[model samples]
Target: MFNPSQFHETVQRINTKVPDVQHKASQIDIASVKLANEWFIPEPVARLIIWLKDELIKLVEELMNMMTQVMEGIEAPITMWEDAYKWETVRGIATSVAADVNPSSLGSTGQWTGDAATAYTNAIGPQSTAAAQLATIADSTASSLRSCAEAGLAFYIAVALVVAQFIAAEITAAAGDASVVAAPAGLAAGLAAAATAVGVFVGLVAAIGTLIGTEASQVSTLHGLAVDSTAFPSGRWPVATNI
Candidate 1:
């Protein structure tokens, strides 16, 4: 019952929405790279920047694929429900006949008799269980996608800060070069400045890494909450048929 056309449409919808988020994140990465370049970082840092950008692009593609699968999983149950509902209608009619033919028999116990009861039970119980399981799968998939995205972002941020530090070091080196023509006392000052810059850069990098780790922790928590919120109760299962 799952229409291929509908699945394709849903995948297209997800793909269309993902680009906007990826673009925004990419812009942030570009800005960071520009800032690093302005500070005169070494060539190695620029290479690293390029690597980070490529990784981010890959993450975006993976996210789109994961989302498409999730969307398809979500759609599958609806199609199954539609088919189940049609079958339930026939079951309902048979139940009515069974009830009329055997008033005292358990088979005549209203709609609970015959195929109607079995169909209803299957729809409300097993079908709902399957949906919940699918939701869990989707949730897990989304979580993995988010993890990859966050890791890529964190790597970018760390590399940017390191590049900034390298740039600062280069500036210190330039100052040291100038001090050679100034005074002997200026030599010590230049050395001290470079050391201070290195220390500050190391500390900043450590702090940023810690922050990124914290953000990653929240990703799983958020995903679990999303799954719990979306989990539907079995009672809400649509009537498979009429009685």
Candidate 2:
């Protein structure tokens, strides 16, 4: 009875200091966490990994964007080819040439316009098909390349520098990961270049195809305008017959 109350007061006094102790402990925990962050690599390498990770992610995104552009580019030449197929000026020229040759034979000559239109459509089909196939290939392959880059970026964080053995293994893994990224990076770039070249080639083919269609129509026009050899003994007919 003499010291029970005294002991109780002492316990309460100790309890008052517990908050301070806890605060100190919390600070220590924070420091430990920071230390853990540098567990496997030195500060420079740690920083480099973060930078490389960000850069690799960016590269992957860039390649994806380029693939989208390449696919869209393929459609442009195809659209041009379609528009050229419907172009009416050449058809009109064919009509005029037909009527000029002989109004009586205009119906027969009109078939030339149909023939040229058919030829123009035929020319565009193969080129457009090829461009579309290339676009599809680029889309699929670039997607694969981006996957490699993403996989490499996954290893960018060097975990717990505190364990030397763990760090060694992680570093090795990171090196392999980096190589994975490097390999696909090259493939994506090459594919972009190839897609660009194919796009240009498609455009050239479309233009040339249109020209060929026009030339074929012109030749048909000349044939229409010519008097048939069968109609004249001299193998030529006069421009006009007796009214």
Candidate 3:
């Protein structure tokens, strides 16, 4: 069985192998801690990973925060939807209800994404279970995607830290392999191999819903709204949901 727990197990396996992973040669001599293709890494790239980890942490933090705001903005259209609904009842449905977005809190940085759009649409589309439950569905869809993005950021940050730590351990154990300049390449190869054996989440996290290819489709109401009212240019379905 392809266990979902493979991700964690592979990370554990990675810590074991990178300083000692399945190498390019293709051997599995784990008894001796040496395999046919197992290899070591170079000093420079290994150090680079450390530096990269530090830098990535800062950048990813900013990304995570920014994305959070964008999802929040996805809900901005709800007010517009409600106001229009009220106007519709009062005016006998004679005027086109308008949608709006306000970025008073997270600055002008928050914007929608393709995933946000798809989520909103899936909830409100005629075929959706949420069409009649727009208020709840809109919030839930934005919240789900926002949460997914946060999870991805956390995953990468953790991966960066783990990668740096494990690779450092590999470097310490490489004292006897100073004669091998091919170690770094081998280390990279080993990481790639482990990543393969692990899963796609090993590299970069895919877009929201991309892991299983389940992004949302457009409905009539969602087709014309702005994807990003603040920064991201995702979808207008959030606005549509309020109505």
Candidate closest to the true structure, highest TM-score:
1
Candidate 2 segments exceeding 4 Å error? 1-38, 65-74, 88-175, 178-243
List TM-score per model, in order.
0.32, 0.26, 0.26
Worst 10 residues of 1 by lDDT: 179-188
Query: Can you write out model 2's per-residue Cα lDDT over 34-130, one digit (the tens) per residue?
Result: 4325565466544544443344334334433433443343333333333433433344443444344332433643454585545544443333333
Q: After superposition, how far is residue 187 of candidate 1 from its true place, in Å?
A: 5.1
* Top-lDDT structure, candidate number: 1
Q: Name model 1 segments beyond 4 Å from true.
A: 1-113, 116-120, 140-155, 178-197, 204-243
- How much lDDT does each candidate structure score? 0.44, 0.36, 0.36
Tens digit of lDDT per residue, candidate 1, span 86-118? 544544553454343333443424557577666
The true-structure Cα RMSD of candidate 1 reads 16.6
Error of 3 at 87 (Å): 21
Q: Candidate 2 — what's its lDDT? A: 0.36
